[model samples]
Target: MQIVVFGLNHNTAPVEIRERLFFAESQAPHLLKTLRDRGIRESAVLSTCNRTEVYFCTDNADSSLAAIKEVLEKHFDVDRRILEGYTYTFRDESSYKHLFLVASGLDSMVVGEPQILGQVKDAYRMAVHSNTTGYLLNKLFHKTFNVAKRVRSETRIGYNPVSISSMAIELSKRIFGELHNRKVLVIGAGEMSETALKHLKKEGLSNIFIINRTFGNAKKLAEDIAGIPYPFESMSDLLGQVDMVLASTGAEKPLIEAGLVLQIMKRRKNRPLFIVDIAMPRDVDPSVNNIENVYLYDIDDLKDLSQKHLSDRLKESELALGIIDGEVAAFSSWLRQSEKNPLIAYVIDKAEAIRVKEFRKASQKLKNADEETIRNIEALTKAIVNKLVHPHVTLIKQDSDREISETIKRLFTPDEEDEKDLDNRNEGQ
Candidate 1:
């Protein structure tokens, strides 16, 4: 079976296009089952804010890709022509490399952000829960996770801890000059919002308000940050009061629209309102950025910070890629060695059969021979068999290239039947 990754990421598609493709946590199992029904036996859908990719193990790559494309079109209600422009397909080594890069955060918009690793782990768990992962995917993801951990630990890729949250804080500082004592309102108490709020708190921003669909979660985050907890219904009231807004809600539609921002700006009397939305299916609308005294930045807008430190990040990326390449070579070698097992097994079995048959024939012919003589003949035959097969064993165990293995296969009898044919010719001789 071949490893294939069919994906479209932030580089290929804009947020407007990607949001429509993002899969909810609850929808993962159903999606996996549908893929299985479509003859994609072992499959995983890694649907994050910036990308939605399907990784699968299949023998018929072309047919499976066609089927996956059909499902993507029907499921996302998008035309094939449009999806085709933004999508990419990878196979074998390229596919594995992409996976390793993604797990290590090298492929993310914010390189080495430290969140993509967890996102990948979550996607893997979903595949495991749905029973959509098999031998190949299980091994591949485990190794990918290990590689990611190694990159994080061994390299300086994540040393500075630059995430979207930190970027949001930087953007806020740029806008307001200082975050100290600024009343910041966080919409949604999810991980992203919590992280942004955490950074804001560290920046000495004191007045914070957290609103969530679930008041309990909002209260918990509010207590953690020593901020105020408010019901999500008070979002409009709090919007006008706060100097900045950090939104990371899971809402499918736009929660902060142009109309809402227009009203809020009017209430603030044109006081500047900076909003950073790190949500996947964006919490704020694109048109809201045009509002008077209202500045809005989405996940894509936050990636501008990565360019500022490109030189240092590039150095880290080179190191991380070196690690990935080493892992890929190791995996390839293991696969090659494993592929030769059947041939190795057959050759050994054939040699053993010959050794036993010759020993039996000698014992019958030398019945009048003394016990010690019989033992000597047996030991001699055993030694001869070992010497004869030793070179072949070395050839099999050597971690050579595919060409060498192919040559070895051709040089030896490929199957038991071929060995038997050679044995018959020797018997006739």
Candidate 2:
């Protein structure tokens, strides 16, 4: 089966297109099962805020892609025309290389961001739990993870400020002078909010508040970050109190609207509010960005900041890619060797069977000969058979050269009816 990856990402498609094709975390298992039911033998879905990818092992590439696209259309309630514009497909070696780059963070909008590796691992685990993963995907992902680890350990790819959270904080600092005195409100207790908070706290920002749908989770995160826990009911009321807001909630609809922000701005007396919305569906209304004294940023807004670190990260990425190239070549060689093993075993087994059958026939006609002569004939036949097959066996064992390996495979692969054909030909003659 061929390894294939088909998807769209931040680099290839805009947020609007990505949002249309996104697969929610809860829907992954069902999606994978549906793909498998449609004759996609092995599949995994890696859906994140930046990208949605389906990696699968299938001999029928066209059919597999059609199946995946059908499922995506059904899930998102989008037409095929919409998906056709943004989707990309890769197969075999290209797919392997793409996944390696992805896991190594080389393909992210922000190069060297470390979160994609964890996200990929989580996707792999979900595939495993759903029983959709098989040998090929398992090997590919495990190798991808190893390459990612090597990249992080051997280079400074992740040393630069490449995350959306870091970029948002940097932009805030540029606009507000210092985050130390700025009142920051983090909506939702998700990983993105936590990351933003971590960056803000490191900048000596002490005034922080966390609000979630569940007060218990909000309180727990608040306690961890030493921030105040605001009730979910007071989200609108609290919007006016903070100078900066980072929203990454799991709400389907926007938590903050343009009118809400306009009211909040009136309360703050026209003071500027830097809002960063990092959620997939987007926690803040897009139209709110047009308001005066309201600088709203989404996942796409951080692209310029992410690009600023590209040159430095590119140098580190070169080192990481070199390592991945070597690893991939080594893995390819191992896979080639594995494929040859069964063929070699079949050749040896058939050769031995032929030798045994010939010896038994010869022994039937040796009754008149002495026991010692019979033993001598047997030894001679066995010796001749061993000598005849020695060169072929040696070539199979020493497949270091491509030509010799190919020659051995071509010479020893007996046809299914070769023995019977030989017997029939001999009898006819």
Candidate 3:
């Protein structure tokens, strides 16, 4: 069997496409079982906010992918065409490399983000509990996790603010010099908002307010993070109360418009406000960036900070790649060595059984001979057979180390039909 990965991610597909194909954490066990029943020997599904990937071990990769696609379509009730364009498939060595990159966080939108490592481990554990894991996948994922750990420890890949939330906080610091004593208003109690709040809290910013459409969620997050919670209806009024505003609400259009900000600024006599908009399609207005004394930074503006961090961590990334390469080579060698064991054993066992049978037949034919003579004859026959087969047997035993073991096995162990054809041709000749 070979390793195969089929999936799409933030780099290849938009969130809308990814969300449609995403397998929830609760659905993984059933999905893994379904894939195993469909002839995928081993399988795992990794569905994060930015990507959805399916890894499997199968001889027929095409059939496996087809089965997966059919399952996804049926489960999500989506048109296959919607995902077909964004989906990518990798097999064998490429699949192995891709998984390593994913675990290493090199494949993330924010290169070197450490969360993917834990996410990957969680997926692997889910697969293990579901009984969808086998030798190949277990070995591959274990190695991948180790590689990620080594990368994180040895490399500076995860040392920077590459995540959207962290980057927003970084931008806020750059504008205001420090986050302490600044009133930061976090709009929406979503995962992104929570992450942003965490980063803000870490920077010694104690003044925080969380506002969500659902009051309970806002209250929950506020209580958990020791921040104040406000109702969504009070967002506009709270806009003028904070120095830094990070908004990631799920509104369709711009929630904080240039006109709204202008009105708010009038109330505060044009005091400087740093606005970090982390939402897609954006919660804050794009034109607000042109407003004087109101610094508005969106996701694109955060790239500069991420790039600088990436440059600083480049050496560590190289070291991580070296580790992954070494692990890949070792795993490949072990797999190749494993393939030769059964073939070599079969050949040696068959040859020994034939030699024993021949020697017994020769001894039965010498019943009239003296006992000493008969024993001498048997000894001589055994010695001759050993001498004749020693070189071949030694070679077969050492086949695990030889590069040409597969070729040698194919030459000696032709299928039964082929061996019969050879015998018939010899007889005709």
Candidate 4:
């Protein structure tokens, strides 16, 4: 099977296109099931504000790619031409390498942003829970999580708060000179809101008003962060009181329209109101920027700031790329070896089975053993199994002689009957 990824990202598409393709958490399972029904197995979808990507294992790359496009066209009602024009495809090494960069935050809009790692983990978990991921995808995602963790530990790329929230805060600081004693209204109780609120709190903002579509959610988040929570209906009333507004909600339509902002501006007597709409669909309307004394900055507005921040993270990014490259090489080698030799997998499985069987048998006899003793026994058995299987595995890899392969396969086979079964399977192959 070939490992492949095909989709559009922030670099390839604009916010409008990305939002159109964005898949919510609840929608991922349906997408995975659809791919499975279409014979594209072991699939996972990573849909964030910045990108929508599908990673899968398939025997025919062309057919699988077509199937994915068909799904997008049929399910999302997107134009096929748009997908063909905006999407990118990567195979084998390049495919997983892209995943590594994404999971490690190297591919984020704000490079070195830490939130993408959690988003990746959530995507993997959703796929696993949907039962769409098999051995290959399971291994790939686990390795991806490890790579992200390693990047965070080994490099300083994520040493500071270089996220969308931080960018908004920076822009706010530039406009206001200082956030101290400033009144800010945050519309959303999601991660983005929480992150931005934390930064604002550190900046000594005197009053932080948080509101959400769900009153309970906003109240809960306010309790957690020591902010004031008001009913969702009071958003407009709070708008006129705050000096700046940070909006990052999942509303389908613009929550703050140009007309509403116009009335709020009149209430503020033309006081300068900086509004940063960081949500995907954009919580604030674009025309709000045209309102006097009302400035609106949407998600796209952060691109230049993200680029400037990236320059400062270049060195750490290079180190993280070095780590990702090494991991890609290792994973690629393992994939190649396993794909080339089924007997190698069989041998390893057989050895593991033997080890487990022996360990269980010994465990029954060691009823009074301490936990440490039990762990040591398990490790000893595993080591013994590996040592016993090492030479045979090395031989099979070094020499691809069919007769030697058959001999080793037979030796590893459970018994005479299993050996016969192996022979039959080899013949069929």
Candidate 5:
């Protein structure tokens, strides 16, 4: 069977289009079941904010991709032509390599973000729970986890915080050293303020003061994220009390001018205050940065830092890509040999059967063996079986001669019933 992935990502589709086709966790099982009904048994769906992808092992890639598109069309009510316009398809090695990149966080919108790896794990778990993944998908996902782990341990791709929300937290940490018990004034209840506040919350800040144009919005946001809500008129009062201020509003002009902060800083005897203005029209005045003991960073400043961090991750990503390439080649080779060589399977099955039988007999003789002792025996037998079978399997894989294949086949030939059982197992896989 060929491994194929068909889907659209943030790179290929915009938010509006991607949202139209996004699948929720509850919907993934139904999607997998539908694919199974359509004759695509081994399948998984990974739907995230940035992308929605369906991975499957199918004998016919073309027909399988069509089946996925059809399902999307019927279930999500998106036109097939729209999918064809925005979607991408990769088969075999490319398909898995794409998965490796995605799982490793190299394919994320904010490169090196760690959330996608957890998302990938969640998707894989959902597929497994749905009974959709078989031998190939199970092996593929397990290997994918290993690859992601290796990339994380080997490279510093995800070492830095790159997103605006994360960068805001980073800046806060730099100023305050430890944000524990430190007060933060979030000067908006909009989406940007909410995102930055959520990031700040993770740092164990003592209190977050949220203010919005509408008092109700501030209260709602505060309740959702466990922050204190304040009226818009209380901005100046909250500014003097808090250690940091994060302003992201849709106002037409600068909300916090130099004069306002200058007065606030003077009231606290010029104590250090960090202000992050992420608004478009600039919530904090540019002259505010010139004020003594008042550190202000506009959206452009944060974007510059984000770009630098992204560049660093991109450099580290080269190393991660190298790791992925090696793994992809090795996994592809293993898949090829496993699919092409039934002799390998037969030998493994035969060896395992012998090992189990011998272990059972030995266990019977040692009637008083404890759990630990039985486990040790099991490990010992497995090691011995692997050691004994390794050389033969290696030789069979390396040799392309018919005589070598025939000799190995004859030596490990199972009985009629055993042969039929092995055939059935392979067929099912």
Candidate 6:
């Protein structure tokens, strides 16, 4: 089966197009099942703020891509012309490399961000849980995750922790010119929200409010940041008081609706409120941006700050890319060896059978020969067999086409009918 990836990312499509195509984690299993039912052997769907990729194993990559495009066009209500223009298809070895790059954060909007690795791991686990993957895909993910870990450990890719959270904080600073006394409201007390809170507290932003569905989590995060913990029910009340809102919740639906923001705006006397929604499925309703004096930015909107962060670490990114290249090459070598296993085994079996028969016959003829002499003869014959089989071994190990290996196998496979004919001719003679 061939590996294939068909999808679009931030570079290929704008956020409006991306949002329509985003798949929540809960939706991944159904998408994978549908792809399998449509004849894909194995499938995984990874939809984050920056990308939505469908990685699959299939016999015919071209046909699979065509079918996938149809599903995407219909599912997202996207025009076929636009979808074709925005989507890209990677096939065979490149598909595997693309996944590796993604997991390693080389393909992320924020290069070297640690969150993409977790996102990739989640996608792989979900695919396995759905039974939409088998040996090849499982191996692919394991190798990629290892590569990611290597890149993280061996290089300084994740050293600075320039995550999406950091970028949001930077953007908020750009808007307000300072963060020291800026009143901030952080929703969802999750890791991403905690990350933002860390940056905010480090920047000396003391007036902060933490709200989460789980009160305990919010209380703990508030304690850590030295902020006030409010229940999730008081979000609207806090909205009017805060200058900036960072929402990183797991809510499937938009939590901060336009009407709520409008009410909060009236309560605040039309004071400007900046909102950063870093959740994958977006916590704030995008329509909230329409309200006067309210600005909304989602995860994708953080790309500018991320790009700036990436540029600052281009040297380390180069080192990380070198690591990725080496890992890809290693995986390619393993793949070549795996594909050639059967042919190599068959060749060895044929040579050993002939070698053993010839050795036995020679030993029988030389009845008086000592064991040491027999050992020498056996070594000589083994050397001869090794010389004869060396070319086939080299051919199998190379990155050449499978047809070459098949041709070599055919040469080694004895023709039964020809052998029988030769035996009959010899008897007649």
- Among these predictions, the greatest TM-score belongs to 5
The residue pairs in collision within model 5 are none
Backbone steric clashes in candidate 5, count:
0
Q: Model 3 over residues 1-429: C-alpha lDDT tens digits?
A: 678999999989998888888878999999889888887868999999989999998767788889999987887798888758898999887788889999999888777888899899999989976878765687789888887787788777888776667777766777888888889888877787787788788888868888988899989999989999988888878888888888888889988989999899988788889988878878998999878889988777776777778787775677778877887787777656634454443344344445556766777887788989977876787587568656665676665555565555456454887456434533533
- Tell me the tens digit of each residue's lDDT in model 1 across 1-429: 678999899999999889988889898899899999998978988999999999998868999999999988888898898678998999988898899999998998878888899989999989876777765676789899999999999888876545677767777777888888799888888877776777778889879998999999999988888989998999999998999988888889999889888888889999999998888899999998887778898888767655545547768899889999999888777646644454554455456556767787879999999999988998898799779877876877775666765665556665778767655534533
Predicted candidate 2 versus true structure: per-residue lDDT over 258-292, tens digit per residue: 99889888998988899998888999999998999
Task: Return the lDDT, model 1, position 349.
Answer: 49
Winner on lDDT between 2 and 4 is 4
Candidate with more favorable, higher TM-score: 3 or 5: 5
Best by lDDT: 5
Q: Which ten residues in a row have the lowest lDDT in candidate 1?
A: 338-347
Taken over the whole model, the C-alpha lDDT of each candidate is: 0.83, 0.81, 0.79, 0.86, 0.88, 0.81
What's the lDDT for residue 144 in model 6? 90
The parts of candidate 3 lying over 4 Å away from their true place are: 167-195, 198-226, 229-304, 314-319, 342-429
- lDDT-best of 3 and 5: 5
Candidate 4 wrong stretches, greater than 4 Å: 163-195, 198-309, 343-429
Candidate 6: segments with Cα more than 4 A from true spot: 163-195, 198-309, 341-429
Worst 10 residues of 6 by lDDT: 420-429
RMSD of 5: 6.7
| lDDT against true structure, model 3 | 0.79
Clashing pairs in 3: none
* Worst lDDT 10-window in candidate 2: 420-429
